[model samples]
Target: MSERKKSLITTINNQRKYSQVAKAAVLSSAMLARKNSSSRGAPGSAAPFGARESIAAISDMLSTQHKKPVRSSYVESDRVEWALKIACTISMITVCLHTPRTIELFPPLTYIILAADFISVSVFMLDSVLRIHYEGIFRCDSSYLSNRWSQFSVFISIIHLLSFLLHCYQLIGKLHFSEISLILLFSDKFFPFLHLNYRVWYGVIRSIRPFIIIRLIPLIVKFKLPKNRIEQLLKRSSQQVKNVTLFFVFFMTLYAIFGIQLFGRMDYHCVQPKTDPNNVTIMDLAIPDTMCAPEGIGGYECPNPMVCMQLNLNAKGEGFYGMFNDFGASVFTVYLAASEEGWVYVLYDCMDSLPSYLAFLYFCTLIFFLAWLVKNVFIAVITETFAEIRVQFSEMWQKKEVTLDEGFRKKLEKTDDGWRLIRLDGEVEAEGPKQKLQWVSSL
Candidate 1:
């Protein structure tokens, strides 16, 4: 459509939205007033206009059903800005936690989380910078440059603190910052050299493990952050981050492979006494073996039907037959089953023993049913919950209403896109917890 046509359409819709909202609000207030009046046994309860008021109130409530939240201070301040900060922090931390670490004994799979963190941080940082650079912070009673701590919110103040510390930290370290680098943490000042927004650097600060996981309120706030038009931007960012992250994972995998080979050939075996843990230890060789199990369980006596340890390889490795087209289920199932880090694996742990998609659908049915029952039959679709949250928060923060809380579309898109994202949503659907009863009845 032409710009003029689009503008007209928008104007009409916005006008309609305002009217609907006003009518609904009026009705809700009228009923609430009537209920209070009746409960208090006020003389007005018997008034002739009482029925008329109630009827009008009902009409208003019905009219307001489809209306959106008003762009008031209550909704804007409490909703939009806060959600943005919280969501950005959460996204950053989630990404960072799954990413690989430079140090051993740290969670091995944290790199995936770290990759996600980088993208999340950059977007949030952009928002923070935008707020700092463009918002009417100057109009407030406090000075922007002077008394930096005055009249700031826990959320905004936290973002500011994180951005400053991280940016300074990055500049401090002479070494280059990788996605997982703790050094180039977050930014405080807007980068004059790179022209990057300082606010985005705040997201990096959010990834600080102590801030996210250790601080419960901050963690919850981070998860509840809002997004804007940058969802598509985030999608693209997620892909870029994942690709870069995968490259690192590949490198690490190769490194592990080499480490395995080096450790494997160390000639540290004691055939005489096999039961001792310290005798001829070899951790490196065990990695690949752990990753890729035996070919056929080698016809050895089975230890357990379900356990991977039961699988064994043939003792003898002769010339020709060793090169079978298939090495059995070991390299595939057992290795794959054992390979995923516990955190990664837990996602699928409660799923049905079926293919991922069906299992996912089953999971969704289960969670929805549970959450619905718990919420007293008020089934707030994920979209609606988020929409309400965004509206409420925007008012709380006293910020401009964000454009990204198109709740239904965003949630639906998340559900329909990529396998992993889909799996997550599918898991949220309604699967009744009464399956065991059904089985019992059938039996």
Candidate 2:
């Protein structure tokens, strides 16, 4: 019985040793397979590199290879950027002040103003180029030529260059105190079409410089939260505002067309009385020109011994007096009435000219629809958009606060004395009150 027990034990021990060796062999084979899979794509391997990683590596290499190096101190300095900003402000002010009439009136200071414009434009062009080079090329990983900001910089640079050239051309004329021979030669030879209107083109180009004030938007946003909020509000409400504008314009145009058809050639004024001085008798005044109404037909009469004159018929000479003579004038009249600005006099004039009292109904309907209904709709749209933005901002602020509180809780720990605030690096920062600890623990 003892011998049989010994044999059984020996057999069991031998089987256990064999199972252990098999397990060791399986683990070693698994480790070798993992090592081989890891080192599959070496320098002398038949397999190629991973497609995704290869493309990423190539893209990184190319981006680093193509990026331009910044060499100019002026392009890198913050002071230079501020200086350019000041120049832009001065340029805007100069553009506002230096009109054609200003140049003609202040002939003695023309050269001085021209010099300032030249300097400002040069600075603008240089700054635009440097911005493209530094911010678009040196700082960006993408190609500068394809960058949108670089494209905008290029366009602005072209405008500044054109403005500078126009300024130089004007300076040449100013230097001669008239159109110089060189200018005439160029104008006649190269730009005969623009010769007469050279000043007009120059004025147009110089006027564009004032739009550089758009650059100050960033500075305004940095300093004022109200401006940023206004920007956000405008962005969010742009589509609604566009719809409202379209509605207003469509109704305004419809009313204008109706006014033109209803009140066309009807606004008559009595002027230039041709009375006989010797005869003291008041004879009936015959309508000389186009009459507003037939003789004693609509109770409309010429009060004075004057000729009937259509004041609104003339295209020029009479300014706003010609309100509803043509399509353009009719549009202006309807727009004015819709805005409720000086519409009472217009209504009375229409009443005197027309054969009936339909003008009252027309103007009342226009004012009610546009001024009351459409204007209120626009206001409501803007108010709703503003409210939505305010709520979104409040929610974002609450989320930020909650995140901060959670992070603080994560960095807190209980100690023997109280609750200690531990940093991310496992260092104790501060100890807090037991109540505060309990509050944080509750969270």
> What are the lDDT figures for the candidates, one per model?
0.39, 0.61
lDDT of model 1 at position 79: 55
The residue-by-residue lDDT of candidate 1 on 1-443, one tens digit each, is 69999999999989978866655444444445545556788674554545443443344335445555543443235454565556556654564453224323564344444344455455445544555554345665432333343223335435535544554443344344554233233331333455333333344544544443332354254533333323433564556556555643443344334323322211121122223323323432232222222334222121232122321223231112111113332122222322332323322321211234533543344334322332332233334545645544543344221211211112212234432111224445444768667777999
Best-fitting candidate, scored by TM-score: 2
Candidate 2 pairs with clashing backbones: none
User: Model 1 lDDT vs. the true structure?
Assistant: 0.39
For 43-79, candidate 2 gives per-residue lDDT tens digits of 5663332332223222333334434575666665777
For model 2, the run of ten residues with the poorest summed lDDT: 49-58
Name the 10 consecutive residues with the lowest summed lDDT in model 1. Answer: 403-412
| Model 2 residue 286 CA deviation in Å | 14
Each model's TM-score? 0.21, 0.61
TM-score of 1: 0.21
